[model samples]
Target: MLDAAQEKTFQNDILDKIQSHGWLLGESNKLNKQLVLYPEDVIAFAKAT
Candidate 1:
């Protein structure tokens, strides 16, 4: 398990990568605790990076 600081850094890195590729990062839903990403967004991200 990640420590608090490690988790924060990991999240920040993911957020930065997503935003850098012009993709939105949705908040995790309470029920599933998963972040939402559209299929096209992922494709675009893949092509961009």
Candidate 2:
């Protein structure tokens, strides 16, 4: 189990690696998105069948 400082450091290191990979960090507008999954698609599919 990591302490607070260690956890922060690990998170930063992971983010740095992700940025280096050139996909998630700079490619994104800013930070992680707050995504939500609505049931609309499932409901629509069920209705169709």
Candidate 2 residue-wise lDDT, 4-49, digit = tens:
9999999899998987888343334432455432345446679999
Model 1, position 32, has a per-residue lDDT of 39
Clashes of 2: 0
Each candidate structure's TM-score, on Cα atoms with residue i matched to residue i, is: 0.46, 0.48
- The most accurate candidate by lDDT is 1
lDDT of 2: 0.67
Please write out the lDDT profile of model 1 over residues 1-49, one tens digit for every residue: 9999999999999999999999766654422325445556567789999
Candidate 1 global lDDT: 0.74
Model 1 lDDT at residue 40: 61
In model 2, the Cα lDDT at residue 18 comes to 85
Q: How far off is model 1, as Cα RMSD?
A: 7.0
